[model samples]
Target: MMLHTALNWRYATKRMNGRRVPDATLERILDAAHLAPSSYGLQPYSIVVVDTPELRERCQPAMYHQPQVVEGSHLLVFATWESIGNAEVDQLMALIAEERGVEPASLESYRHTIAETVARLSTPEARHQWAARQAYLAMGMVLTAAAMERVDATPMEGFDPAALDEVLGLPERGLRSAVVVTLGYRDLETDWLAGLKKVRWPRDRVIVRAE
Candidate 1:
């Protein structure tokens, strides 16, 4: 019920008051996203934290002059790898082994199975599409976390990915910008949507029982 209230409290804030998010609150929100589940536990996306005013200035044009891009306290750019290569898979394998206190070789069979299946889509276009989807999962986690923190966040997709990539120097890292979210406090006095009620489909219409 508390979660539901939080969800209701959240809205796509169109304007922010340019207040910085407290470090502790920001950390908890980020931790919630880090704990989000990803495909094969690979966690292929990297969240780029942008808080500098100068950096946000550069990002403004890339985001098509969205006020939130410059007004928000922080901008989170969720960038995903272009593709999952052997080196990438190996890194995850090593981490998993260390985290689970097991030999890396123990995960060899599972690793190969994933590679053989996903390697077919190793092409740039295919991987971008696949990686972008996983990024959305993290986005969902971010939204929920933001709500829990009583912070305002706007899930944004209105931007040029190629332009943002160039600005962020993502191509050098073999990463491409997928999605973004802005975090801050909404302008209560000026925001028109502040007093409106949230509307959604009823549960019976959206939730179907397979049985």
Candidate 2:
């Protein structure tokens, strides 16, 4: 019934009542994100959880003054590595090789192939964009996990990335904020979307099959 639970639980939460989400629930959401798939098994993203009132308050301006930024019990900021360098690729390959008991030389060759793939990227921006796309996959997983736990969430894309990066000290880690989600209990009174019916494209129109 896991799939049924997932399907029955998902919703784009509109408002949060500021009730604290338990650490256990939060960790479950993160575990779901950790299990998300990524390209080449190279997970190039990290989650930044902001639980402090002061930090969330400071983030409001960066989030275009979205009240949820300050009202939600927690802010999950998804960020991706700024650049894919040789050292990072080498590290991943080395782990894969060791786990598989492969020769270092063979691993080196594989690393070269990965490097070539990265080099073929049109620019650093393209590479970062690709990584950000992976981050979005993880974001989707976390959002669904939150919904499954009966937690409210708001996926936000309107924000000053530069300001958030500076505030979160992401540049120091060679990462940049790609997206954000606020999670907590919903404030039904103020959440206009809470009572509205959700609308989506018909399955026939959105999905195509070739036989």
Candidate 3:
């Protein structure tokens, strides 16, 4: 019920007040993102939180000088792996083994299933696209959590990805920027979209039942 309320209350806030979300609330939102499901349980992405004014200023241009980029309390960059391969699968297998208290050898079959998916992707571009989808899942979680916390969040894909990646030096780390989110309280007086009704397709039209 709370989630439904929050979803209805939230919008892609265009302007944000200079109010900072509490550190505790920020943590919970991030935790929810981390718990987001990923293909093969391998989260092939990382979140870059830019809270410093200097950093936000540098990132603003990359994001086409979007007001929320620098106006919000923090900016979240969801960068997915540039590519996926056996190395990544091995690392995930190792983590699974350690966390589950099982030997790596025991998970060979499961690892092969993941590896097969990676192999089918073949090209780096294909793999990157898949990784980007996983990043979106995490971003969705962040949006939901922020809404529930009464924090305003704006998810934007209007930025130049190459510019943003360079601004954050993501390539060297084998990462590519997929999406971004800005978090803060909305500026009700200045945000024109504020106080406006939320619009959506009627459920019957949006959700089609399979015959």
> What is the per-residue lDDT of model 1 for residues 16-132, given as tens digits with 9 covering 90 to 100?
899899989999989988998887877877888988989988999999998888888899999988767788888888888999999999999989977775687768888777878
lDDT of model 3, residue 140:
89
Worst 10 residues of 3 by lDDT: 122-131
- lDDT leaderboard ranking: 3, 1, 2
Write down the worst ten-residue block by lDDT for model 2: 6-15
lDDT for 100 in candidate 2 is: 91
Candidates 1 and 2 compared by lDDT, better number = 1
Evaluate model 2: give its lDDT: 0.84
lDDT value for candidate 1? 0.88
Candidate 3 residue-pair clash tally = 0
lDDT (tens digit, per residue) of candidate 3 on 73-110: 99989998876889999999989999999999999999
Question: RMSD for each model, in Å, please?
Answer: 1.3, 1.8, 0.9
* Clash count for each candidate, listed in order shown: 0, 0, 0
Candidate 2, residues 137-156, lDDT tens digits: the string is 99888878887888877888
